[model samples]
Target: MRIRTRGYERRRRELELLIVADIVTIFAWVLGFYGLHPNGHIDFLNPWLTIVVLVPLGAHVANRHLAADADAILLPLATLLNGLGYVMIGVLDPTQAHLQALWTLISVFAYVVCIFFVRNPDSLDRYRYLLAILGIGLLFSPMLPGIGENIGGERLWVHLGSLSFQPVEVSKLLLAIFLTSLLVEKRDLLARLRGGGLRRFGPIALTFGLALAIMAVEKDVGFALLIFVTFVLVMWIGTGNRIYLLFGAVTFVLGLVVGGAVLPQVHQRISVWLDPWKHAATTGYQLIQAQYAFGIGGLSGTGLGLSHPTVPVATSDFIFAAFGQELGLLGTSAIIISFLLLIGAGLRVALRAHGEFSSLLAMTMTIILALQTFFILAGVIRVLPLTGMTLPFLAYGGSSLLTNYILLAILMRISHRSNQFNDLREGTTG
Candidate 1:
């Protein structure tokens, strides 16, 4: 009885937080719309507006019945970020807002489906090899002769009839699952590997090398770097070995040097990062404009949609710059803090997960989210070279939004199972 009451209480708290999120989200929407259309009245009949109000509420209600004891904060945090992102997309590019809204609907539907169906995430370990193969296939799918897309010099998209999407987005999720399952099974062997490090690491390296090679071929240096970092961190955690970490650092540095020397795309990015003014009118025009945007938005902001960011791809890869331009340092700080909180919540879930696989899966997903956020933000600020990647929930891309929502559902499921198991043990003891 006590456990059941506690579960209900947690759900109630989640509801309250979600309500707050919704209020903030709606305000942001109104503010953004107002900034864009100062004299116009909001169209209440818009389906996008309806979705903004209802989706999180609906997800919360579903969780009350389906996953009552899941972490109270994850959904609300996600909702706030997703909502803010949606508003920013509308402000930055009204044309894409409709498409983004449709994607959000589909993504949330997928999230609910995942909650209902994925009862045992650990069971996925049984098909680790198959998942690995599938991930590899997806990674290379864009490289296929006919369907491959060469958009803006990056061969990272695949066109299937009238539809096209980045397969790597889905591949990353599958690969993370495969890596977690493999690590759980091989942690001991990997930990004990002292002298035969090269031989032992060979298989893992080969698999990851293939992934990196494909990314290089596709000119996806950002994802290549992201996955490499994630793999190393997860491997270190799984095996409790610092050797892997050392190896990863050395290899990363070497790869950068070699890539810069050999790959024109990689070389150009590094060169621009080192000195954007050198090509300010041509190659570095986007970064230069982004820097100007930040400079214009000094303290508070120029006001939403008023900055009129001239940076290319301002709606996706450079969305942070757009936010920084309109909302200034304070707004960007709030975003950073939100991400930090989200990452901390994810880590907490991993720590309390019921099994090694669950913990690993949670950790892997969080790492991807954390690193991707860091990489993009750093790139935008010229801390690192720009990596033509979407800013998760904030970016106007169907594939990224869909993949992230699915991952969020899985995280919530793991949290639910973990807490429920704890309740059972306590009840038994009592």
Candidate 2:
């Protein structure tokens, strides 16, 4: 009964937070409209404008019926971030805002589908190898002739007639699932480096080779780094071995050296990172503009739509710069805090998961988010080379948004399953 009571409280708290988020989101939209059209009237009744509120409200209702005991904080936290992204994108480029809203609606449908159908998290483990193959194929699909696109110097998108999308966005989620299941099954073998020797080491070398191939062939340093870092971290966690950490560092350096020498893209990125001003008018223009945006943002932003971010790709890759220039330091700090909270909540779910596969899967998903966030933010500030990766839910990309929502749905399922197990145990004891 106590467990049931706590679950009810969690549901209530989630509803309350969602309400607060909706209210704030509408206010932000109003502010954006005023800034964009100083004298124009703001209309909150428009269906396009109200999608944010409706979507979350509908999801909350679905969760009550489908996953009542899931983590309360994840949905509200993600909603807040996504709402902020909507307002920022609307302000940055009103033309793109409607498309973003449409994508959000579609993503919510996908999220609901996953929550409704994926009742058993462990079932995914059964098809691990097949999923891994499909994921690898998707990851390299952008390299295919005719269909593959070379946009803005990166071969990361596929064009199908009039439709275009990045395959890596979907590939990442599948790869994470595969890695989780594989590590869980091989934990004992991987943990024993002494006897396993070359056999166990073979998997490590293959993973490293995959990362190198991505960097060398795909020429996407950001994603290659993301994949390698996630693999190393998840492996260490799965085996509880510090040796993996040492191996990871050495392999990372070797990859960098080989990449920098052989790949012009890698070398050029490093050059631009070291000194953007030298190529301010050409190669380093975006990074230079981003730095200026931060300077202009100071402590408190220029007040949303009031400040124009001239940085290229301000709506997607460098959206954080848009936030900094318009909302200032206070706004960016709030976003960072929210991500930290998300990481904490995800780790909590992993810790309390009912089985090893679920636990490892949860951890793998959390690491991907954490690393992706860090890489983009760090790159924006020039702490690392700028990578063309979107800022998760905050970036305006339909494929990315859809993939992230599916990830969220999976996490909710894991959380719900864990809670169900706890409730069963409580009943048995009583």
Top lDDT hit: 2
TM-score of each: 0.95, 0.96
Candidate 2 segments whose C-alpha is farther than 4 A from its true place? 1-4, 427-430
Worst 10 residues of 2 by lDDT: 1-10
Model 1: worst 10 consecutive residues (lDDT sum): 203-212
Per-residue lDDT of candidate 1, residues 168-201 (tens digit)? 8989999889888877887777887566556658
Error at 81, model 1, angstroms:
1.1
Report how far off residue 248 is in candidate 2 (Å): 0.9
**Candidate 2 lDDT over residue span 136-169, tens digit each:** 9999999999999988878899999977888898
- Error of model 1, residue 399, in angstroms: 0.2
lDDT of each: 0.85, 0.87
Residue 104 C-alpha lDDT in model 2: 88
